[model samples]
Target chain A: MPIIINLDQVLADRNMKSKELAEIVGITEANLSILKSGKAKAVRFSTLEAICEALDCQPGDILAFSSPNPSQGGESN
Target chain B: MNLNTFFKRLIDLAFYLMVPIVVFFPGTILYVLMFPEQTIINVNIPYVENGFSGKALLFSMGFFALFLLFFAGLYQMRKFAGLLLKNKLFSQEVVKRTHKTGTFFTACALGSLIFIGINSLFSYEGKISVTFGSSNFNLLLFLLIVGVLFLLLSDAFKKALAIKEENDLTV
Candidate 1:
């Protein structure tokens, strides 16, 4: 629940647009936005690996921990 | 992938299931009218309680009504797949159809209830008793299924609509 996506900074550092990163990661622009905006509920490890590899960053650079989110604790509906 | 499209397809599948019963019920009546003595069963009359085709009608429709659940599953899968595609594989209008999923089943449920009501009102001489038949259970089951589907669709629509408000925030 505390996992964070710092894809925005990574993209900027790598001179990559969100769409470009999404294409490289085998995802969609919308999905990239969701991940970048922290609206994504879950992230596949494969996706994280792809992103890390593309931006030449470690997973630690893209992810951080914050206070637990209520929505992340359990099923919403 | 759009939630509306997913919902609409659910509606389509429900109709696919319902259309047959819709025609079958009245068609059976017409068949009966055209051939009244065709339903004959020379069972031994000893210790006989009313046995009627109303239950059969109910069960048949129950099977038909049950198909919407398959649609519901399809909708869920489609929702996930659409999300994966992020509106590229599917469209927004179609995904939101999940909002109206209830209306389709509600109409079918109503039709079923109407059928039950109509059947309840009439008992042809020598026809089976209406009190203890497969019809009664099916009536209740389809009603429950329809009610639940409506509620679920309503909830799903709310989630889909929430996106617009998020858009407002970003804009």
Candidate 2:
């Protein structure tokens, strides 16, 4: 739950539209949104490679780990 | 008795069987709504008449209504199932209402079947007898009550589910 998807940040830096990237990445808009919202249960390695190649960024630039425990200063219920 | 799941299955099966029956039986809306004076139900037996010929129109209408009910039930199942799968919506209160509604619809369907069956069984053809009786009476009341119960129940569950949705932004 704490796997942060910094998809929006990557798009902002790359000056890309989410829809365009979604199309280029061959993913549905809804699936792309799930990635954007950090609600995706898992991201395919192929999708990760596509995102990295598209934005010309390393995986670290797009994903970071966040603890789900609110006591650890991350999102929680 | 899990009326929702039970009736839901019945509704799904009935819809599959009845959709073509309802559609081909009447090509136009007006045709389905307005009863034909006399209908020959079985073609093989050149002289077999149906029970109260135009009444089959009523039966068809009832079946069509069942189709609508099935659609609505399928939709409700989809919504609740999505919520359940996504871990987004649940409350003991909601579960309780679902139980009550299952009971209500089951009771309504059963009562309708029983009353219609008994009255039709005993009554003579073309008798002005009101066994299911007076327009403002018990049968009419039961129909009205059941109809309103389903309408209100559907609306209430919708609102309750909406309230359970998480906005994430903590508004």
Candidate with best DockQ: 1
Q: Model 1, stretches more than 4 Å misplaced?
A: A68-77, B1-171
B87-147 in candidate 2: lDDT tens per residue?
5445544454444444444444554565456546645476565544454346545644655
DockQ of candidate 1?
Answer: 0.03
10 residues in a row with least lDDT, candidate 2 chain B = B40-49
How would you encode candidate 1's per-residue C-alpha lDDT over B7-58 as one tens digit per residue? 6566567556765755565566446445646655332222123443555445
Tens-place lDDT digits, model 1, residues A1-77: 46577778877888888877778889877777877887776677898888888899898888887655565463221
Clashes in model 2: which pairs?
none
> Model 1 chain A: which ten-residue window has the lowest total lDDT?
A68-77
Best by lDDT: 1
- Binned by DockQ into CAPRI classes (incorrect, acceptable, medium, high), candidate 1 is incorrect
User: lDDT per model, in order?
Assistant: 0.59, 0.58
Q: What TM-score, over all chains together, does every model reach?
A: 0.34, 0.32
